[model samples]
Target: MTTSSNSSLSDVEPSKTPKNILLLAIGSMGDVLPFVNLGVGFRRHGHNVIIAANTRFRSFVEEKGFAFREVNWDMQHEWENTDAGSPFMFDFLKQGFQKSYSNSESVLNNVDFVVLGTGAAYMYPECLFRNVPAAYVCFYPWASSKSYTGAAYGRSFDSLQWLPFQLNVKIWKTIDQVATFWSDVGLLPIYNQRLKELGLPPAERLPWLPGGAFEKNQIPVIHALNRNLIQIQKNPLNPLEIQMDYPSLNIKEELKDFVPPHDLVEFLSRGRRPIYFGYGSMHSFSDAESRVLIWLEVMSLLPQNQRALFSDVGNIKMKELDDAIKSGRVFIIDHIPHSWLFPQTCCVVHHGGSGTTHSVVRAGVPSVVVPHFADQPWWASILHRLGVAPNTGIQANAITTDKLFSALLEVLSSEEIQEKAAKIGSKIKKEQKRSPVSKIVAYIEKYWEKTKWDVLTLDDEQQKVKVKDNWRQVNGNCYGNRMMNGNDDMQDVYL
Candidate 1:
């Protein structure tokens, strides 16, 4: 169940016992950045906060001055391009989950709240076991709703464009079910195995994706998105499934004095603001070299008077494109926060990630969204609908340098789109002063306050616990004097 919009933040009194808050950042830097910001909020509220993410992101997270923990492993190592009977990393789930459990549970000693990012669905049961007040944070909308639509497995809801609306959702659910089969084939065994080891009952697989049922039976779900730019469906079934603006700030107040390297600063001063071209962690699995060349060639073809910035995430060294880099018009950067860089650019060319889309819009700039896959085309459509991006958007698979150049030109030249972008930026800036994290932590606080329950930790030292008369059993799990059941309605488990 969701907390009321009227839940007053003032009601969240300073805790007599500051809780340990753990945030899991399982995907890319975009996924991790928001949590770091959230951790900063928790820190200010007099709680100990830890940011756990990929090993590679330690410095990035630590730079924000939060304690850090290495998650499963570096995402790149897991997703390394492999065609030798390993199309995906399903075979690696056992090692990964075990590693995750080993590393995470050790620090979860006092973790009162665990904020699970979009990709950390497997960790749900562990939270249940620990009885930690957990919440799921979704960056984009994938579940099918009658009023709003999104992409599924890199295909838009409109892929089955001719089907009736109900049929469309059914089709998406079917597709997600098949994908879930393969995914569960890898994760479910590990999940149940982990539970068995903990002496917990094996859980029946609950609805995860499609039909937007992922929110069902899960922890309170927060959709961190800008409502103004997104066309969410007409119906929102769950009051707890909240949608809020993606914070304009990705770092804390202490790190706000970020200095772009002197070279980057000099490059910006030398010419007109360069258009940015980047695809975060895109093409990490296949044809990376060819994609790199295509990106550079498009940057090279920019109007002679215009300059461009390109992110070389793949670290492909250039033999042929050396001239373009030497031309002083193209700057290749390894990593820079979009929070600082996007506003300096006249426009952006990106993969239309939820984070990047929000970043560019909040930076007061228009962009050309060249979506590669999953929620990207969805964001692209939102931009087009909002008139912040031109047309629908260019699909990455079919992109040509000429097509990219033309889209770039459209974004740069369109005054209407540019102005609308600036207005949205202004709104986000105003909201930033109020701090989304304050509201978020308050929601988290409100959730725990409403459900004043306790947990009996089931660990090696304590396989079972002696309980008072207040503790009772339901669905084979004990809740602290709470009455809940799955027999009636879509079950909300030991919540």
Candidate 2:
């Protein structure tokens, strides 16, 4: 076939910019940063991005070079203030759901697509109810054959035997029921107030993600984490891996010129490959004094050759660190980007957060996991079984130097643990190049090309799974009911 020379030589622009995309998350730097990396990816690919998250991250989002859209999910703030104070945590979940519902339109207005983390997926059904096309983007797999969150927190974490498929169905039904109650009553009012403040319309319930309103089988998901260790392999791209080419934040260079508070720099420089001791946004200590005491206790347990860098992310005052802040063995700083800090450390002493876990594992350093609650414990268990760290997850309130020291020593002195960590680190170094955002963009592009911009949603048959009420019967209401105790006046945040 012959073609005209002018047609062959004509310059053509790339596809039109993708309609607005809604990016959502909750809590600290962990929940937010990965999405920012994603937003950077979308922008490079000619997509407009808007972030829907708690207001606390507004400055951090802007700083990272992305546009920020605020949502009224204040659970992290409430948790930080009240030590997650029982019912407060329950209410926080409720409020987050309500806000997610109320903010749907704002999130969907003129939106061509959506990408969300684990926290955002809980609200995905509502987007479907609103008839918005969406995809679930995870840094980690949600459906591992091993103890995934849906199975573990579903009251089956300890069972030695694999759960029957029917049993798994029942487990999720109970969780959805418990979750719905929290969303409807416990948190809706908070959501309403936030919407009023923002001058955005309140969210109304809609069909859930990729199913119900959308086709179940047509659902598109982009799982960002490395595939080798992931237990489940359901997606089209199992072991989905991509080359990551993120621009460096260069935070170290920026911080190098600015003089840190007295003794901070000297202490950081003086440590003999010190372990970092901070819980990110989660508070392991209730009061500054107690936090300081914990620092002193942890420091006392470590040999003088090793030191501890305490991050005050929860607003932990250095004064509470007391003498340790001046002890030349301890350094307290407000924040340091994990991307820059993890590579330099000999070991990481952390709260077992998923993001932190991924960072340290990628750095290939051994860890001392002091998991407090939730998925942190689950991650801690995985690391311990893998021989990457010693299990140090005592109740955050009960941690003492003796307990802390025992866990820290195992990682620091044991060649086996160090070797294992180094091995995992080598694997992570290879996997880090597999960028989650790029894979997601690729999925979207392929979908767009196949559908010719016609949005596709999941179908019902794909969504259908056997329901096992018996699973709930065995678990005995795993999420026992508790009401929020709002007037608990004790308020403090510790790093």
Candidate 3:
């Protein structure tokens, strides 16, 4: 492992040129796709970029013409086999972390820099020990900031602005406890033991703790949501949190020579702009059939002039939908790029995965977000807050045919909703002078330069103190007053 001398940001140049970059990402297609897009951008900028992810995504990664390293965990299999309510879910996550860390160690010796997703950021201590410059790229907000409640706790807080600073802190700490339960049981001991073997000090705790990784490392944290979509807040907490445009990979040019299914094309061409329904990689519902039934019922409620398209990626079993298929009212698609398909749709209905939410926003189509789990509800709230989707999007566990029908009807019938979505979409398109991928690459380059010579490193204790100080500064003035007063303008604050 290389060690850096204590120096300032401008003085510590290990190299003058960009080095071979290793991008580590894990999770659903939503998590992996943006990194793939970033890898393409890096490659275009003459950097040797390689993506390390689950073994299942090897073909997907290689198809994009980048080197791929298998991380040896299949999230789909884990999701399918493990019961949602079971404690073994943590064990599944633990196994994934272990394998990803091991795989990352095997490859890091050859890489000069690293880009990690929030799931993979736990390896930052390892990167620090190796003196490898690393930064985190997130699809959603991960770090705790006064600008917004942490995305992990988005479901818990009804109105963050109404809560006091201490209460908000307690909310985050409680969330940390739940996350810590998983880490302490599955990852911490193993990681610490390995650190001992490597002759490096063990981490005090998991990095996901507030002020743990983001502040401790002080690395550039890139958030890939459109700036326009993120509600701006006064005195935002984290100076490290950088907002970049969501990277929507241009698959259209690549798919131009390719052909889409004739049935799908014909269905779209014939319908009065069909509504799209897809729960990408989400299968957590206890009653899959019931959910499908509700969707079918919602479709039945629609006028004969309106149509619906469903992506059969998640728990929706298509064989059981033979009746709907034969009736030609609902079309089941295997896998299609939202970039290509969403533009043709009148509206989209989906589990609010970050990737899917951005696609709907980019497509400028009004949506009914039926969130299944984890950050989906948060994205749903953002959509609703932006007026692109109806308020209080149908929760997965609470979803009913009536709720679906009503939400769909409201979006489809509201010219204001349609217009709002289109305006937001147009604004996003206008800001696409550089792709989100390019912006990410540029940020990484800037990070490399800024950190190459920095000597002002903070130890764990100092980092914790700094975090407290920063929080105090944010909560001391008008920000705290507005939050405590339950000001209506609080909702307008950007995160």
lDDT of each: 0.66, 0.54, 0.67
Those runs of model 3 whose alpha carbons end farther than 4 Å from true positions after fitting are: 1-18, 83-90, 153-190, 231-239, 250-258, 283-289, 313-320, 453-495
C-alpha TM-scores of all predictions: 0.80, 0.70, 0.79
Encode model 3's per-residue lDDT on 288-392: one tens digit a residue.
Answer: 576677778888788977777867635455554778878787787777878789989999988888888888898899989887666777788778878998765
C-alpha positional error of residue 418 in candidate 2 after TM-score superposition, expressed in Å: 1.0
User: 1-495 in candidate 1: lDDT tens per residue?
Assistant: 223353333455534357778898887777887888788778877888988887888998888788887776555456454231232356565566777777666646667778888767567656655656677787876454544454545554355657886676556554544554555566668777776775565543422442222343434677788777764542233445566666434434524676779998999999898988788766454466776677677766667878888785456677755677788878888778787888898888888888888888888899788776667777887787788888567887688778877787687778998999889888877767777777787677666665553554445334233111111122233221121221212211111
Which stretches of candidate 1 lie above 4 Å from their native place? 1-16, 82-95, 102-104, 160-187, 207-218, 231-238, 247-255, 283-289, 313-320, 391-398, 455-495
State the lDDT at 183 in candidate 1: 54
Q: Give the CA lDDT, 0 to 100, for residue 446 in model 2.
A: 50
RMSD of 3: 7.3
Q: After the best TM-score superposition of candidate 2, give how far the Cα of residue 170 lies from its true spot, in angstroms.
A: 12
Off by over 4 Å in 2: 1-17, 81-91, 129-131, 139-217, 235-271, 313-322, 453-495
lDDT by residue for model 2 (118-182), tens: 66765554443343456655544322232343322312222222567546544544443445455
Mark the 10 consecutive residues where model 2 has the least summed lDDT: 486-495
